[model samples]
Target: MRSRLFDAAGVACVLALLYLERHLAPVPILVIGTAMALCLLLRRAYPVPVAAAVYGLAVVQVAVRPAVRMVDVCVLIAMYSVVKYHRRLLWGIVAGGGAAAGVLIAALVEWRSDTGSFWTVFSVVGAVTATVWASAYSVRTRRLYIASLEEERDQLARLMAADERAAIARELHDVIAHSLSVMIVQADGAAYVVQTSPAEARQALDTIAATGRAALTDMRRVLAVLRGPSAVVEERRRPRLADLAESGLALRIEGSAGELGAAEELTVFRIVQESMTNTLRHAGAGASLLVRLERSDGTLAITATDDGPGSVAGAEGHGLIGMRERVAMHGGTFAAGPVDGGGWQVRATIPVSG
Candidate 1:
């Protein structure tokens, strides 16, 4: 709507200019000028057609009219509109044709008029034509640059969103896999000794319930983060090295509990959880797992060793792959292999820098 209003205003200005110069030009010149000026009304919407009409009128006026009128300026505006909105190749052709026609008209008018010099008339026409075309071409280049920037921004946004989704998937996999492994083991143990050891079976049931509740809480936290700004997301407590001991795992920390970014902390916690879960799943009941965290020289080192009959070669699951990806994301190194004489071990070293 705004553009249309601007085009209307341009057309009105041209018409007024033509009316003021009506007496100076002949009837044929006046008619051609009026047609060319009116064509500006459709310049933006139909730039090529308006340009063609203006150029045709210019040719007719040059052939018949004795002198140029103020309305002749509308040709430059039409040329500008064509260059601004049309394709580059088309604009190039129009600009070339307009320049050539302008030179021819200047030569013919100079010959017809006995007063003005040829160079003066030609210089004015060439200058106006070049100025309008150059201005429009610059504007076109700027618009294209801006559009390319917008496209790049959108692409970057999509990539970031995909990265975020992958992170969420890794978190969910760790939470669900660990909790389910514990619950399943506890359930099986309870079923086997229900009659012989009623108290032990009841304790196993309680453990399963607690694991389920913890898994549910973690899942809700993850979902809240994914649901966007409208949802009131709460900061949930993330697991630390101490959490391993609290969970009754045979875990020990051997370094200062250095401060870590939220992302690094979450990655460490999930790696530990998944490792312990895998140990429980493969090592069966009465198995012991050991976790160690060490901070030194701006690097965090994590090692998990389990006294379970596990093979690193056989540990080809999504959980292990997720751990490797997390380590790699922070430019860290990861290794998982069987110990010299016994169980399996997983180790990762992550750099901590801004």
Candidate 2:
């Protein structure tokens, strides 16, 4: 709506100026001025064609009448549209040709009259043409810069989303793998003693039921995080070191757990979960495992050691790789190797800033 009003105003101003200077001007001049004013209405839609028409009319006007009138302002407006809307190469060629034609016509009129300075006319027309084109080019460059910045922002958002999905995949793997290992162990024990030791077999069945329930709870929590922003899952479901005691593992927490960020806390939990799962799978039955979490001097440290046979080598398995990646993402150090006393150990230290 604002643009339509401005175009109407421009046409009115040009027509009024032409009439004020009409005195003894030819009918052709009035018709040409009106045609050029109408062309301004289509400047934004068809800038090149409108600019060509304006320049052609300008040449005719200069040839017929040597005196300048306010209608000439239309030439600047047309040229500004050409540069602002059209590509630079095409606008450059068209503008250059039109400027040359305008200058030539003006020079001819001044020479024929033999009363005005040719350089003064040339300089004035050249400066106005240069000023309008420069202004339009500046605006075009700024718009292009803003478009590039928007494109870059969109690309960054996509990368962050991909990273989030990968993290969720790792968490799901840790939860399922650990729960299934414990269930499988208990099921095997129950099958072997079902007839010979009824009481023991019944105890194994109870353990299996408890492990299944815990697995379902943890699975739901992980899935909730994947349901996007609308999900109302608890913000933090961190597992404490004392939780390991129920699984027949020694628990030791040093200093304080302190206040860790969400990502850091999740990373710590997954590392410990994966470590325990490996111990349950490869360590011998009745093995002793020690789980520890400590915070000191702006760093949080985690260690899991098992007193089982040193059979679980630190290979590039998916579980180990996921644990390493999680720790590295938080700028932490991670290591896993066989301990001196014939056992496997996994340790990591993550920096935590308040």
Top candidate when judged by TM-score against the true structure: 1
Q: lDDT for each of the candidates?
A: 0.79, 0.77
Could you give candidate 2's per-residue lDDT for residues 1-354 as a string of tens digits?
A: 898898888888888988886885778888888898999999988988898899888877876777555687788888788777786647855775676567656655665678567787777777777777788878878877898999999999999889978977887888788888778877888998999999988888887888788777777777888776555356345554444444433334445567877777777777777777788788877666776778888898988888878778546787899999988988999998789878888999999887
- Candidate 1 lDDT for residue 316: 73
Worst ten-residue run, lDDT, model 2? Answer: 244-253
lDDT tens digits by residue: candidate 1, 194-237: 99999989988988888888888888888777887554246466
RMSD of candidates 1 onward, in order? 2.7, 3.7
Model 2 residue runs over 4 Å out of place are 1-28, 60-69, 88-90, 110-116, 193-226, 232-259, 311-314
How many times do residue backbones clash in model 1?
0
Clashes of each: 0, 0
List candidate 1 segments past 4 Å from native: 26-31, 63-66, 230-232, 241-256, 312-316
